[model samples]
Target: MTAVQQPLAPHEREMIRDELLRSLTKLERSLKSSGAAARPRDLEQDTVGRLSRVEALQNAGFTKNLEAREKAQLEQILSALRRLEDGSYGACNGCGAPIPFERLQIFPETLACGTCARG
Candidate 1:
């Protein structure tokens, strides 16, 4: 039989919520500043040398990838916040198990517990 797990304490929930909010704010600012770097640049031969153009293209690609990752993380944070509001924040979505407080402390946006996440 599976054991029942206790829900998160109010203070613990508040702490995690605060951390998630802080992360959301930081990521939003980062995404805003990185928007220009991810844009396509003018790669005309006369405008920029071949090597410079290649470097610019590579940099843009890197920036785009970074922004994509940040955007995904932002979404995860938002989802976690919603779960918090709905009284489901620390519960694993897969099996309805309580995610360990230690794990939540490290990954406040996670939706699954370690076992379910690995599977």
Candidate 2:
């Protein structure tokens, strides 16, 4: 028979919630600062040399990729916060298992347990 998992303690949930909020704030700040770097640069021949223009384009692409990753993390954090509010933050979405506290400490925004995540 499967053992019933205990729910996260109130303090544990609060700590995770605080960590998620902190991460959300940090990502928002990073995205705001990075917005300028991700903007398209004018590649006019008279304004910039070919090599320089190419470099600028490459840098912009890198910045855009970084922004995308940060945005995705921001969404995950937000979802986790919502789950916390709804009293379901520590449960694995994949198998209805209570995710281990150690895992939650490492990944406060994760929705699935390690086994589920591996699959």
Candidate 3:
């Protein structure tokens, strides 16, 4: 069953907006970071060095993937911002109807209301 929604206070909406902005900024920085390695050295410490480099590369890859996902979500949030500017933020994208304030609170970047989104 759908829960009743309470409209966001100005402070709450501001907090979510700030969070989205921070995430976007972090993602942008992550995308610009120098990558894991330049060249693998063929020195005597090859085993340990290569292992450590491989681990670092794996971690960087995971971080990059996560940042990309966050970036996409932030883009969706920015889209919501555009909708807000146009005075259409709370309306469902699929149908001409209001989106529940609760849904928006939980997922401010959502474009579709629960009903339309389910489909």
Give the range of the ten consecutive residues with the poorest summed lDDT in model 3. 34-43
- Superposed by TM-score, candidate 3 places the C-alpha of residue 41 at a distance from the truth, in angstroms, of 12
lDDT of every predicted structure (CA atoms): 0.88, 0.88, 0.64
Q: Residue by residue across 8-32, what tens digits does model 1's lDDT show?
A: 8889989999999999999999999
Clashing pairs in 1: none
Poorest 10 consecutive residues of model 2 by lDDT? 1-10
Candidates in order, TM-scores: namely 0.90, 0.90, 0.62
| Candidate number achieving the greatest lDDT relative to the actual structure | 1
Query: Of models 1 and 2, which has the larger lDDT?
Result: 1
Q: What is the C-alpha RMSD of each candidate to the true structure, in Å?
A: 3.1, 3.2, 6.3
Better of 2 and 3 by lDDT: 2
lDDT of 2 by residue, 1-119 (tens): 13226778889888998899899999999999999778776789998998999899889989999999999999999998888887777788889798999999999999889999999
Candidate 2: TM-score? Answer: 0.90
Which sequence of candidate numbers ranks them by lDDT, best first? 1, 2, 3
List the candidate 2 regions with Cα displacement exceeding 4 Å.
Answer: 1-5
TM-score of 3: 0.62
lDDT computed for candidate 3 = 0.64
